[model samples]
Target: MSKQPQPAARAHNGETRPSYSERLWVPVWWWPIAVAVTMLLAAEIHMGAPGIRAWLPYLVLLPLPIWVLLWLSRLRVEVTTDADDGRELRIGRAHLPVEVISRAAVVPATAKSAALGRQLDPAAYVQHRPWVKPMIVVVLDDADDPTPYWLISTRHPDRVLAALGLGTASEPEHDKT
Candidate 1:
């Protein structure tokens, strides 16, 4: 039996008014890496001192349990964009009200050069997942709260931004030089 709990809205929540919802997990790229690491550990254990090599299988498989737990826990995240009833953007446990959201934009590719150099306020909330690419930048209008924005990694950044009434990302100008 899997100890990791399932996403909400499937169980006792009973609320089914979400306009948009998506579940995101670690990207496909991580799978091979995980396997490679496991193999590497096994290889190392097999080549270790005779006494230590006796525990080869156990040592190599050790990270498996930890990997599974992490894969279930931190590597998976649910993104819920509820407009009709909740009027909020939900990513895992944290949520942002649609009303408080000022604006949203797809993080430009050039942002890599800047290394997250755009609109980084001191009191912002960031929910970053290493596996996800093309994160969305959401600005907040709530003056009461100190948080300036939310930088979240999502597979469907456009959809999430659109759920916040941000529409689509503007195409950047290309240089022809």
Candidate 2:
């Protein structure tokens, strides 16, 4: 039996550059489920005791975090090329269009954390896996909305930049002064 061939890199204007997009999903651990279950159980136990019935409203709010997590997990980016124009880009339920993209590039790991205006949270946080950096950030070409940047966690930052034609040789020369 012959093995199936994998999809080849997509070509744009005779140049082979695959479209790239990264989706943000919840870590594939049982933690979300465990948290949901623990909250349910704790709420049940708290409500079971006498005189705690008055606090039922608070107990009912225990599931809010789980709902939030599920909602966030559904957030994803869909990157593709426009067959007619042949411009590669990504779109999502909540993202600006690729046509609105002004710049894209791989930022060194240290700069990535700082550029996002994010602080390392010691308690609980999502730290990009070391192997995933240097991560790619795309600055969108919008003025009214102003801040339109995407700090995507990806292993193939170069491929992503190439696909969008944002990592051109001309860009680096300007930064080397």
Candidate 3:
């Protein structure tokens, strides 16, 4: 598939499609949320000493996870192609190209936890699991091997796959008499 976006394509009959780097660095607050929550948890451990004041600092940590959840809810995906044939997956500096990816797909309900090595979510109940590292699976065409896959974990799976022009394989047809 062609990597270039249509030159004629316009965002709102006025705006143009963002360039590769511009698209890549757009910040999603989810990263900060993840960072903050981690810091809060660490602060709790540090402050959990032996005095009555120790309890107050840890109590402040209770809301850290909630902020992470809210940030996750607002997550976004930004995708683009690199200088080579590889594709770039981004959500605020967290990027992975096709080479780093072992597999990708619009994981089906029947898809197993082969990636995770354990079952937790229905997406994980299948053969491969995402290992809790959420990713969108993109099955590629014209690939050399059977694993024409690029796995990227992003909050916006649908948008990421659509931007890359990748998709899942169609099931085989049944034989008739």
List CA RMSD, all candidates.
6.1, 11.5, 10.2
Over 4 Å off, model 2: 1-18, 30-66, 94-102, 118-134, 140-156, 167-177
Q: Write the per-residue lDDT of candidate 3 for residues 124-145, one digit (tens) a residue.
A: 2122223234355654443433
**Which predicted model would earn the best lDDT?**
1
Clashes of each: 0, 0, 21
Give lDDT: candidate 1, residue 173: 86
Which candidate model has the greater lDDT, 1 or 2?
1
Q: Judged by TM-score relative to the true structure, which candidate is superior, 1 or 2?
A: 1
Off by over 4 Å in 3: 1-62, 68-75, 80-87, 96-104, 118-135, 138-150, 154-159
Top candidate by TM-score: 1
Displacement of residue 157 (Cα, Å) in model 3 is 4.7
Q: Give the lDDT of residue 103 in candidate 1.
A: 81
Model 3: how far residue 107 lies from native, Å:
2.4
* Residue-level error in angstroms, candidate 3, position 23: 14
lDDT (Cα, tens digit) per residue for candidate 1, span 15-90: 4345566656665666677777777777676774578666767666867955774654453234344334545577
lDDT of 3 at 54: 59
